[model samples]
Target chain A: MPRLRIQIRDLSKTFREGGREVPAVSRVSLDILDKEFVALVGPSGCGKSTILNMIGGLIAPSAGQMLIDGAPVRDVPRQVGYVFQKDTVFPWRTVTRNIALGLEYRGVTGPEQGRRVGEAIRLAGLAGFEEAFPATLSGGMRQRVALMRTLIVEPEILLMDEPFGALDTHTKLNLHAELLALWEAKHQTVVFVTHDLSEAITLADRIVVLTRRPGRVKMIHEVKLPRPRDVIKLRESDEYAQQYSQIWHVLGEEFAGHAV
Target chain B: MSEKLKINFWRLAILVVGVGAWEWLTGIKAVSKIPGLYFIDPFFISRPSKIVERFFYLNSDEVRLTLWQMLLSTVESTIIGFLVGVSTGFAAGLVLGRNDRLARIFEPYIIAFNSLPRIALVPLVTMIFGFGLLAKVVLAWLIVFFIVFFNTFQGARGVDPDLIHSARFLGATEGQIMRTVIIPSALAWTFASLTPSISFALIGVVIGEFIGGESGGGIGYLIIASLGTLNSADMMVALIVLAITGIVMALGIKQVEMRLLRWRPEYQQR
Candidate 1:
């Protein structure tokens, strides 16, 4: 694949809690190829965000190496967009400036900056809201703004940490569809983290299920559903139930008390 | 232009009404004073005429180089002191806020120094700087330091962890993150703190003048001189002038804050 491939090997992270060692992410490895839309599905606090952070270079693995483009990941990738789990809008700037932020940091200025920001806003369905402040935007709109902000920089890879996790279920599903549409248009390698099985199943080209407490790659499901996927149509497919049930059965033990 | 003029007209009308009410009440002996309305008399304690006279004499070439010179002197001292104190405090606060270890080490020393009566050293400052510009400058700086330091420290530490993490995720270098997100975030807090910081500075400059005074002139010195000569009117006059100037300086900073911080939460309401 001409796209970026993230290879995680023996990665583990342990935090010192009350003079005792507690592991967040146990020895785990993952191989995501170029232009591959991969979903890391796990329950809340299952360290899905942690793994995304490790790949995004926001945190260091206590005991492992991550290879990107066949090279060791030491710092933030020069061409990767890391979307946060929450709205990342700077309150000081309007939606336009917020969207242009990554590009601005990448040294885009004047006409180029303005044009890129305009296109990003349009893509995010926020064209009429360029001058609107973040405080005024709805939760969904803000998340959309966050997405465009990262995507505008044209990174080869996109690492999103529960981008729409904070939104309502309806908003989350709608945004999932929106994101898939954008991804289909761009075909950028995306690693999305989420607790929602449907979101993972609907959006990912391949879904990697993670175990709870000292997170490890519990199982990997190849979402062989076809391109430009309609989430509704895909959900109704026989393969969807088969894969969802298989993964659910494996994760059902951990979902013990958190069945909801 | 018309809207603006209307607003100004309303402001001036309110000012006139206030003044007229005061003038009438005091003139008719509605208020009490030392030996009746004599002190309350606008013509005696801080007469408008006397302040106007002083205002016009701001640049006379006589022994007193006009009110302008004194004002300039006061302004120079105030600004220099404020900048020095603010910069130094910001630097120290940055160090302390980020490095809790360093803060723990020097915190006791800072508290001890800050708690001391800063005005008590006015006489000592006068002795060292010799009634010259340096003396006033030192006094001004002394007054400005603690406020700026404490506020900047709080501001620096109060930077949003979310913002910092966002910056790092966006591939912001440590320097860029500090310069763009953290500094601006802290600046909002710092400017808000500056409201009181500047008030303290006013006290600093005025106290310096009262304790000893600059080479020859200052509003503070004028107040003292008038008091020494039993000229309550002149003292009142100087007091009014100082009050007006102080209020104006504070308002000026506030206006700048408004323009600079249009994004602040306080303004987010309307």
Candidate 2:
């Protein structure tokens, strides 16, 4: 078994606005092993993104602790990378320059940065548009650039907060495949956040569903689908249907809570 | 291509017709025999041909210094003022933008200074700086500083917070974020603010020269001298030159902006 890469213990976050406290996450704890692909799925406003933000060190936990590789996160750690839900690629930088941002920040040598940027650009299907600005590229292409930028830094843990949430269906499907291939190859501890349950099932090895607001772990489903599973084709398989319903059964109660 | 050519042709035609009508109306020798048929006095209105003729004569002669010298003086003041104003304003905006407390502390004073009629301060500035290069430069700087400062401040504040967060996770230090992200973002706003500052810088120089104290000769001074001597053609000639100078200066700034901001998608079209 791989060693634990991320450990969250008694984690809770309460936001104070105008002196009124609003809790976002309460005592939500999870242990993600090295090379594990975990998908956090919940209804909207469920603090899934808030959890990811804490892991990435973009925000602090109001209580408890978030540890990466056994060390508590005090600030943004260099070993962690994040892909935001929104287009976070700097529009002023060219595609190649955008991908090389992290490497440049780390003070990697010029030639090394260029080589890594070239490889990541090829991996992300951004080979030809190296000099194009983000504004000129399509939404999908910019997101690919964003992914390449995060990956080029080679962080040990990747925390993606609904990175493909804004893409069209066709683009989303293509990106899902691309992301899976990249994750499988790198085997980095990946924690992806999504509101779509089927998406969580299609991509993750273990799906952790959370309840609606003040999100807490509701259930965890271990997907038994074989390796190199085709997302769309796997949907028709008996095991896929069984696991989907099994997870949906647990999620149904969470959705009901959302109405009240 | 034909549509573009037609537009250009119409623009030229309008200019020609307008100038021709003005010349006809103000024709001194041509209307002298018509006996009270004059709608305009040539001595006051000044025909375009007479102005051009006056331009050539002044170009060769020195009436309160040569036309070239006066233009050079005005250009020098505008350039000095622009450089000082833009650099100081951009630097101050960058510093205060990151420090919210300092920005808040200074906000009221900035607003008060910006609201004052800048032209009304010419007498005070001339008294302090003594109607020299410094006076004109100070006046031009005052005209440009507030416009660029406000835009730079807004631009720095408006930088996408998500991008900053991403950069921080990417291991960018505070200085790195400021250099690669905040500064470039503010540069766009600074450039937008610069377009108007170019005209205002020139206005400041002209206004300073028109006030006329010690460091006495510029295009503005020539216009003032011409008006004083009732030489309407000289005044018109100087005004035309000033207009041309303003256009040329604006075009020069545009060229620099285009070259520097080629990374921009919208500007890439040109």
Candidate 3:
């Protein structure tokens, strides 16, 4: 078995708005093994992103402990990377410069920086647009830049919060294919959060379903989909349909009483 | 005709008609004889031709050197004041924007100071700094600082929290985040404030000179001197030069803005 990459023990988060204490995530605990792809799915306002943020060390947990490689996470670990849902690519920086940002911050200069940034540009299929700014690029292209920026740093654990949630179905499928190809080569540990159940089934090794607001683990279903899988073709398979139905049965219950 | 050509034609037409009417009205002796119509007195609102003639006379060799000296003084004070104001305002804005405690402590005082009609302080500033370039510079600085400071402060404060989080995740130190993220984000606002700041700086300097009288040897002083001697034509000539200077300065700033902010969508080349 692969070594455990992340350990979450009774992790919880409560947010304060005005004078009231609103619970976002409650007593959520799960372990992620190295190179495992886990997807957290639930209705909107289910604290899916709050969980990802806590894992990435972007926010302090209100209670409970989160451990990465047996060490408590106090700040963003060097081996961890996070891809936000919003288009966080700096509009001021060009494709090359945006990809080079992390390396530049780490004081990696000279040809080494150029080589890495060039490789990232090629990886993201942003070759001819190397000098192009974010404003000039399409929404899908900009998100690719945002992804490549995080990927270039080569983090061991990649926490993504609905990274492709904003794209259209066509672009979304294309990105899913690209993402799977990249993951197949690197096999990095990934914890993805999404509202789309099909996306969870298509991408994850395991799917963790959570209840509506004040989110808790409702069920955890392991995906037995084989490796080197085709994101588009797999949706047509019976096994994929069965897994989707099973997860949806649990995920649908949470959204039954309200608009999703 | 093209839209731009049509617009320019109308603008020129308006200018001709306006100036032609002004010249005709001032030349009418009967209109001046009527007490109620004396508002357009030739001695006060001088005709366009006399104003143009006075402009040429000021630029003539006999008086050109003095005019040049006065123009240079005003330009120097305006430029110096603008630079000082922008730098100090930008620094203050960044610091206050980044520090909540500092902003909270100083916000009330800043708002109070900004609320005061800055023009009302011109005489007081001139009195303290005396009738010199220093007085004009100080007044210009006072007017420019708040314009730059407020815009920059808003810009710095309005940076997306996601960007800051992304920078931190990428292993950026606080100082690096400030330099790479916060400063660049605030720069758009800072640049937005610059055009107004420069105009206000010139206004402040001229107002300072107005209060300082002829002792402050600048374009403002020349205008005051013309006013004292009742040479309406010379005063109008000085006013035209100032207007031209303001336009030139605004154009220069536009060029710099376009160059610096080419990354912006509006400035991007197709």
Candidate 4:
């Protein structure tokens, strides 16, 4: 068995707004093994992002404990990288500069930094647009820049919060293929948060479905899909449909009684 | 004709008609002598031809050097005040913007100072600095500092928190984030304030010179001297020169702004 990379026990977070306590996530416990791709899916306002934020050490949990590699996470871990839902690519910087940001921040310079940035740009399929600004690029291209920026750092744990949630079906499929290819090479532990049930099934080794607001783990289903999967063709398979409906059955229940 | 040429033609036509009407009413004695036309006196509103004649007289070899000297003094003070104000304001904005405690402590004082009509302090500035180039520079600096400071502070404060979070996750220290993320984000707001602040700096320096009167040598001093002698044409000439200077400076700054903000969509369209 793979070693457990992340251990969460009785983790909970409650936010206070307007002098009233607003619970976002209740007591939740789970363990993620090394090299596992775990997807967290739930209805909107279900604290799915809050969980991811806590795991990435972006925000402090109001209660409970989290351990990464047997050590408590008191601050943003050095081995973790995060891709936000919004396009966080700096508009003022070019594609090359944006991808080179992390390396520059770490004081990496000279030919080594150039080689790494060039490789990342090529990997993201952004050749011939190295000097282009973010404002000129399409939404999908900008998101790819954001992804390549995080991926170039080569973090041990990649925390993506609905990274492709904003793209259309065609762009989303293309990104899924690129992401899977990159992951197959690195095999880093990925904790993805999305509301799309089919996306969770396509990418994750395990899918954890959560309840509505003040979210708690409702169900955790292990995906038995084969390796070297084609994101588009795999969706048409019998097992894909079986897993989709089973997770959707649990996920759909949380969406009921809420306005569409 | 193209749209641009058509607009330029209309602009020229309007200027010609306006100046011709002014000259017809005041420059020609016959038109002034007409019934009810005497109210348009050259004494109050100088004729365009007389002002142009005064402009040429000032530009002549005898007085041209003095006129250029005064113009240079005012321009120098305006440029110095702008640079000093922008640099200091940008530094203060970044410092206070990153530190909430510092911002909270200084917020009330900043608002109180900004609320006052800064022009009213021109006389006080003259009294303290003694009606020299120093006083003019100080006045201009005071006017520009607050404009740039407020915009930059708002820009820094309004940076997307997600960007900061992403930077932190990428192993950026606080200093690196400020240098790479906060400064670049605030730059858009800082650049937005530049045109207005530079204009205000010119206004501040002129106001200082106006209060200084004979003690200072600038276009504002020339205007005051013309007013003292009751030479309406000379006053109008100075006013016209000031207007032209302001327009040219604004256009120059706009060009620089476009070049710097080429990354912006608005600039990219052009």
Backbone clashes per model, in order? Answer: 2, 0, 0, 0
Better of 1 and 3 by lDDT: 3
Off by over 4 Å in 4: A257-260, B30-39
lDDT tens string, model 3, B1-270? 999999999999999999999998887766545664643678888999998887777777877447767788888999999999999999999999988999999989999999999998887887699988899999999999999999999999999999998988888999999998999999999999999988999999998888777677788988888988999898887888898888888888888988888789999983
lDDT of 3 by residue, A1-260 (tens): 89999999898999999999999999999999999999999989989999998888888999998999999898788898889999999988898989999999999999999999998889889999999989999989998999989988888899999999999999998899889999999999999999999999899999999998899999999999998889889999999999988888888789895563
Return whichever of 1 and 3 wins on TM-score.
3
For each candidate in turn, give its C-alpha RMSD to the true structure in angstroms.
4.5, 1.9, 2.2, 2.0
Instruction: Give the poorly placed runs of model 3, Cα more than 4 Å off.
Output: B31-40
Model 2 per-residue lDDT tens digits across residues A20-72: 99999989989999999999998888899999999988789999999988899
- Per-residue lDDT value at B90 in model 1: 75
Cα-based lDDT for every prediction: 0.79, 0.88, 0.90, 0.90
What would the per-residue lDDT of candidate 1 be over residues B69-93, giving only the tens digit for each residue?
A: 6666677777777778778777777
Find the number of clashing residue pairs for candidate 2.
Answer: 0
Runs in model 1 lying further than 4 Å from the true structure: A1-4, A232-246, A257-260, B1-69, B99-106, B214-216
State the number of backbone clashes in model 4.
0
Q: What are the per-residue Cα lDDT tens digits for candidate 4 across B130-232? A: 9888999999999999988988999999999999999998889998998889999898998999999889989998998888876678999988888899999
TM-score of candidate 3 against the unseen true structure: 0.96
Q: Is candidate 2 or candidate 3 better by DockQ?
A: 3
